[model samples]
Target: MSTNTLYGIFDDEEVLLASVKEIRANNIEIEEVFSPFAIHGLDKALGLKETRMAIMAFIYGCLGLSLGALMIYNIMIVDWPQNIGGKPNFTFYHNMPAFVPILFECTVLFAAHLMSITYLIRCGLFPGGTSDSPDERTTDDKFLMVINVDGDSSPVKEMLTKTGATEINEKEA
Candidate 1:
């Protein structure tokens, strides 16, 4: 099936945000929006659900902490049992104070690296990824709102124009 996509380019973030609200109020479904910089409340305006990245980060951090604790326990108590600075290494609990830095570092490392990978994968922004932007101007100073219309794009175009769109373009796919 063929579909028509309408691109409404806006000169300002405020205009784009207002346009999004207006279009959504009119029961028009927006495919996506592109902007040069982050616009506050844009996600809410787009009606996007809250992201679960923080939850994932917490899980990754817990995994890292567990691994760090296990590694310390195995190395200090089970395998080598080294006595450093006259501190007892007989039990994992006794040596936990010394391993606090390692555990903290491991948690941060896992959370940061895993979160970065997850974000890249979720955004489809791996190395050598192609851009999905409809217009190059969106990467500069313009904000572009994309709407997929099955037929009769005139109403959408008219709405875009009424919402203060600087430019409007239509594409078929």
Candidate 2:
């Protein structure tokens, strides 16, 4: 199905945020918003759902901890036992103290790396990916708001112009 979109480019993030709130209040469906930097409270203004990246990070950390514990147990207790510093490696429990540092480090490493990967994938920003931004200025200083125009776009365009949009454009998708 063909879709028409109205794009409002603002010079400042504050103006974009206020425009988003006003547009949503007018029941206009916003396709997306593009900004050079994170605008504080813009997510709430856009009514976006809370992110679950933290929960995923926690799960990845747990997996890393388990893997680290298993590796340590297999190396020290099952495969080739070591008796470093006169401490016995008969079981994981006996050699647990020595592995604590590795466990913590692995957990943090997995959480950070995996979360970064997940964020990239979620944002469709992998290697050799093309940008989907409608305006190049959005990558520098301008803020852009995209509104889907299901019906007439004059009211939406008028509202955007009234909301301090520096430039407004219409396109079909």
Candidate 3:
């Protein structure tokens, strides 16, 4: 059996939401909704869970901080330490200002670079990867609804027609 999903594209969020309501009134199942930007109340309307990207970022920031601190501490204290202009080699409680720059730089470097890499990986975005979205216009002013019906799409399309949907298409996996 062929396993595929169908999508209905709309030009505006208002029309999409209205159509979603119409589809739900007809008791149809929607797999997902895609938009270029956040549509207010969309999460509640579609019953979606909160994103964990922020949490991942926070964890990544902490990792950066730790890595930076450890690298600096080791190099300044244990590895190839040398006195500079009569200053102390390493002083955690005394000459902290000197080490602050490297510490801060490392933290920012890891967070900005590694966190972004992690985000891309987590989202399945890689260089030259094929696009997951069907319509190229989805990145523009279009909103898409991917529907997964139970039995047949006859009634679903009939209900979607009343929702102001502009176009419909199918995708296979």
Q: TM-scores across all candidates? A: 0.96, 0.95, 0.80
Q: For residues 46-107, what per-residue lDDT tens digits would candidate 2 score against the true structure?
A: 89998999999999999999998988888889999977888867878877887899999999
Candidate 3: deviation at residue 95, Å? 2.8
Per-residue alpha-carbon lDDT of model 1 for 41-105, expressed as tens digits?
A: 99999999999999999999999999988988888899998778889888888778888999999
**Model 3 TM-score on a 0 to 1 scale:** 0.80
* Model 3 Cα shift for residue 20 (angstroms): 3.1
The clash number for model 2 is: 0
Scored by Cα lDDT, where does model 3 land?
0.77
Compare candidates 2 and 3 on lDDT and give the better one: 2
For candidate 3, write residues 29-118 as lDDT tens digits.
Answer: 778888998888777777678877777767777887788777766777778677878777765545567877877777677777877887
lDDT winner: 1
> What do the candidate models score in CA lDDT, each in turn?
0.91, 0.90, 0.77
Candidate 1 structure lDDT: 0.91
Better of 1 and 2 by lDDT: 1
**For every model in order, what is the number of clashing pairs?**
0, 0, 0
Q: Predicted candidate 3: what Cα RMSD to the true structure?
A: 2.9
**Deviating ranges (above 4 Å) for candidate 2:** none
* Candidate 3, pairs of clashing residues: none
